[model samples]
Target: MPGHAGERLILTGPLRLVPGTTEQILSRLADLGRTVSTEDGVTDGLSVLALSVDDVVLCLPTVIMDGRPRRWPSATVDRRIDLTSYAFAEPDLISAYAPELIEHLNVGHADQMRQLARHARPAETEGDIAGVQVSGLDRYGLDLWRVDSAGAEQVRVAFRQPLVEPRSLGRELRRLLDQSANTSE
Candidate 1:
């Protein structure tokens, strides 16, 4: 927290769709005692709000307003919130606080990702017969490794619907296993 009051903090993560106009966003910031100013032109292909608190500045990315649902097109944002991803208009401020800020964000993001993966059930058995191990996961689905008498084979299991969270992936895997069992019978 100790840095140039002019140092900027940018939120580079996906924002939840808030149903409101741009003025509403400014008003909300005002309610939080942050006096933010908006720049309409291109900054990383998105309009952003600039805020200065003490010596540090904060930039927030705004959603593209296209008269559609405010939600992001993807079910989940794969990228982590990284402070280094932000560009500092002031070059002098970059060497001062960017490293510390990026390290903090990286630590937090790693912990959160580890927790999500921990909740993931990597291996599952189907009625004491077929067994599968989840090798990886993505927004689309699971990377499964099936083990059988023939041998172990890698399989990609895509979800019919985009998965928003690891828990949903678990449920989808169960559903797929059930469907597979029913078919085999």
Candidate 2:
């Protein structure tokens, strides 16, 4: 709080952790008579920032709207957020190497992306399928970028269950791909 003026501060993380956390921070800010602005939305393609405070690891997404960098809305993230004082320090394996994973998926697996895109929504996948790419990956799911003659759209494809470790990412993704392929046949 040293460099922060408490002006228009935006706190974002997993939705479960943010609201309660914001309440606590707001309480402190109220003591100083400061004001803040907060917004919420559902998105999975935002950039992530990992924060390690004490023993807790928080992976927060950052969004850029209207060509300006902005903090992601508080409602974007996987479930299960702790509210107590430094409850768990468990590592977020997915977030740790998301950039590399996303890059690999996008560059190496275009056909699979198209297959996975089949599960997005009938409307979303109805256009003249131009291209598909994996834009974001989290423990809960994958956010796909689908471009068609009409335009570009974002699609969310969730895992069967929340992934607990990095080793399962490939398995979950494979399961999704296989399921999608089978559905199309």
lDDT of each: 0.45, 0.67
Q: After superposition, how far is residue 163 of candidate 2 from its true place, in Å?
A: 1.3
RMSD each, Å: 18.7, 16.0
For residue 180, model 1's alpha carbon misses the true position, in angstroms, by: 1.8
* Model 2 lDDT tens row, 54-142: 32334444456689754546764323335453444576788777888889888898888877776676556656678888878889999
Residue 176 CA displacement from its true place in model 1, Å:
1.6
- Give stretches of model 2 more than 4 Å off: 1-67, 70-87, 123-126
Please report the TM-score between candidate 1 and the true structure. Answer: 0.30
- Per-residue lDDT of candidate 1, residues 75-96 (tens digit): 4223333344334443343234
